[model samples]
Target chain A: MTRLEIDHLYVPVAGRTILHDIGFTAEGGSLIGLVGPNGAGKSTLAKTIAGLLQPASGTIAVNGVALDTMDRRDAARKIAYLSQGDTVHWPLAVRATVTLGRAPHSGRFGTASPGDRRAVEAALHRADVLSLADRNIQQLSGGERARVLLARALAVEAPILIADEPVGALDPRHALNIIGLLREEAARGALVIAVLHDLALASRFCDRLLVMRDGRLAADGPPHDVLSPAGMEQHYAVAAHHGTHEAERFVIPWRTLNAADRKPNQEGETA
Target chain B: MNRLPAPATSRIGTAPLCLILLGILAGLMLASLTIGYVHIPPGRLVQAAFGMADPATTTIVQQLRMPRMILAALVGASLGGAGAVLQGLLHNPLAEPGTLGITGAASLGAVVALYFGLAATVPMSLPLCAMSGAAIATVILLVVARDSASTLTLILVGTGIGGIAIALTSLAMNLSPNPWAVSEIAMWLLGSVKDRTFSEVWLALPFVIVGLAALLAAAPSLDLLSLGEDTARSMGLNASRLRTMAIAGTSLAVGAGVAVSGSVGFVGLMMPHLVRPLVGQVPSRTVLPSIIGGGALVLASDIVVRLIAIGPELQLGVLTSLLGTPFFLYLVLHLRRQLP
Candidate 1:
């Protein structure tokens, strides 16, 4: 029942346009992966959708109401965002850190209600950090801290969850663990938008993919269609190996595109 | 009524810690009343406290000792609370009024007022000017380092601002019209609660109360900020509003303290760190305890000044600076070890 619609969105930072004419419509019950190379405005787009950045133009409507007019608390209650490499400044207890996600619903004074407590507990459980709840957040390993931060985001219980590079800089096992958690959240009916660098994981796990290049949306469709070899070379400048594992399509970037790899007809146009 | 799980490392509950600190503060206040120059016996101290004793004893207790004690507590509490709030807001353990150059800016402002002879004519101008200076410093720090605010940038910029303010204060003294003005300004800069009357006490009380309340109110939002700014905002925190409140509160509280007692450095910096271990590092929980701990510290320090009976009565600011400089160095060394 949750719908997020963006139309003709333009985001400018320091007079430089970072997101150009971006528009998309997403709803609950699906996992969407935002894929692009560095400086492709993937993070910018995620931030705009999460209401962290102000779009210079266009409308962002949530469930038919324009986001511009929505109360800050109401918007917060609907959208949970986890920034890339999010850090805890203090060595706060893990449970205390997760409990902060209840701020939007905990009223002005931040008095915790029973529902807030329940939500925090459930989020801790969902993110598989329940055992570390009593430990100090700063003392945790990077992977453990990632789960704790994810738990903080999940504690919001929002319909739309936006995570920018949620699994970056983690071991392969921890990365898979976080991706699995994101999938579970989507399966539970939240619209999860994750900015991912792993093409194989995106292709296998994401229901849909939105590809970005030079601050523009290059392609949008099912990952199978959007992550084609031609699209991969054109957008990400990567020559990828494509195959199917157990009937599910996957993509692996084999090597960076060089001038010799391009066909004669495409050679003169661009790299 | 609190349900948040206590930190596993926490030795005592926050509530009990606060109560114990409060008890200690109360006991210290009582002891302070009895141990002054007159040495009113504990039995007579109670009578004087309620205004039932002879007029002279009553005057000594109510007019002299009471205002001094209350002012110390208020100033100390504001300094401590401001430090906790700033540290949380900036996500920097080194952020405090002293380290951030706020107290120096406030001192410069008061010194300016004294230099121009405005304080003698218009007493309100002193705190007003001091608060204005502090607000300007806070705004400058925010604007100049708005982007990353790395430790290097914050500390360097703060040192620059503080250095400039202190140098300017010295310049004002050098250009003073007479020896009396220089001596008066110099003595005030040493900082003490000596001879403070109810007028000075009343002047600082409202600002301290309001500032402390603002900091306390903003404490919970600070907890959100620990997750970083973008995440905190997504969690419905108004980061800009929080910044405004923290700046205004620090300015008012630190300014008022400086106006009455010159610049009592390092109370803000030390109190939070001292109390942080007891209640855990959660910013909100750290705040109340830091404030109460600050009150206790200044009260005890003021009593120590009286007990030591050093030459010229040992200015409170000088002692704290003497103590604080070493603590600040230790903290810097500690941070270096931790980071690398």
Candidate 2:
């Protein structure tokens, strides 16, 4: 029954506004995709929502508790955030890194309880990294590392999960598997939000879409409605073609155009 | 995959490991008392320890040897614990008190105290000035190496400051009017536990105890920081506060050790690297073991220094550097091979 709400959130970095007047709500058991072009502030928006960055002027609440009012540990218990490109300096084992996600649950002394150990094992199994549990994280392949990090986030067992490009470094098969995992989390009543670069995958996997243009929310609705050719052309300035295959809609962007071609066309005008 | 022998289940948490470390430390203290220039056999040492020995033996054992042995252990533990904290704070295994300028600053402070004829007037003045110098140098390093700087930059800055401090110390020693002062400074730089008294141990105990307590409190925070700053902050730690506490504590402990024993090397830098994997890479679990392990290493080296030389007793610092330099080179080579 947890819901994450960002109301009129405006985030600025070093005096320049990055995310402007953006708002969204992620209810439990929902999967929301945040898709945009480069420099559209998708990552910034996600970071702000995860409480990694403070908004310039806005309110972010989880389950009706304002983020500013909650202690860090309490907020962490509600929302787990996985950044885009994370690296570890220490060569910790897979099991050890996953155990760190239980920090919020563990007290100041940092001894893991039996319940914490059970959660870690469950997370490792869910991310399909149980076989490599003892492997050093540094020795893992890129896809394997990504899955390990995802497992760490899952170990938090927070009601809301925010991942910024979690599958960007994975292979095609691994990418689909991660998306499937996110959907599974959502089905289990966790609110899952992911910022993705691949529009086709986003459309196929997400239950809802949030499209951004220059730090503003350009469209928010079902993927079928918000991912139309007109919306793509308006937000990305590219020509797109949409088609139905095997009961799925696929979107393909062909090319961008010159400034002259971007003007409104007259009724009698020829190409 | 050859699994790292499952870290023995008994040593899983910080509390159990801490207790085991204390037990080992107590045993090592007793062993240190038994070994020395004159092998007062264990039975005699224990009888001497209980104040039931012959007058001559009691004077030699209780009056001279026991205090020196305890001083060596205390100095070793302080240096080792401080070194672990510094390394964790900088996120660099190479960071140690000597390399990071705290030792050099302390040496300079001691020399300055001697030049002003303060040591003869007030014995505690030397250690107090040395602690102040270490604190100042640590603060300078922290300011120069801001929160966002890389570990390499921090180490480079520390080296630069340390070099300046050493130069200043050498200058002070050379310009002193008293030849006795020059000789004293030289001996101090060589680092020894010889001729130390119980009063000197008491002078150092408070700083070391407080510094170690501060470090232990910050151990869990250091574990969080190993994941990197952003992740640490997201997990509810104030990274800057943790770093400051660690640096301050290291300075206090290292400064006091330097004041008492001169610039003892390698204990801090080597102990954590050796015991970290044994404790499952948790910084919190590593602190106590590092302290005990550090004390053991120094006391053993001191004993070896006493026994090895034919004429003059070799300095403790020289002994550690002789053993540590090759191990350090091996580590660099191993790290190079591991890096992509």
Q: Per-prediction DockQ scores?
A: 0.56, 0.32
Question: Which stretches in model 2 have alpha-carbon errors above 4 Å?
Answer: A14-17, A212-219, A224-227, A256-271, B1-24, B109-125, B136-149
Q: In lDDT terms, which candidate is top?
A: 1
Candidate 1: the clashing residue pairs are: none
**Interface RMSD of each candidate, angstroms, one decimal:** 5.8, 4.2
> In model 2, which residue pairs have backbone atoms overlapping below 3 Å?
none
Which candidate wins on TM-score?
A: 1
| C-alpha positional error of residue B232 in candidate 2 after TM-score superposition, expressed in Å | 2.7
Off by over 4 Å in 1: A263-271, B1-11, B49-56
> What TM-score does each of the candidates earn?
0.95, 0.89
Among these predictions, the greatest DockQ belongs to 1
lDDT of 1 by residue, B1-340 (tens): 0122454366577789899999998988887787778889878878988999999999999998998999888888889999999888887878888899998899999999889988889988888888888888988888765775687688778888899999999999999999999998899988889899998988788887888888888887888888888998898889899998999889998889888998888998898888776776777777888889888888888898888876668888888888889998888877775542
Model 1 has fnat of 0.71
CAPRI tier of model 1: medium
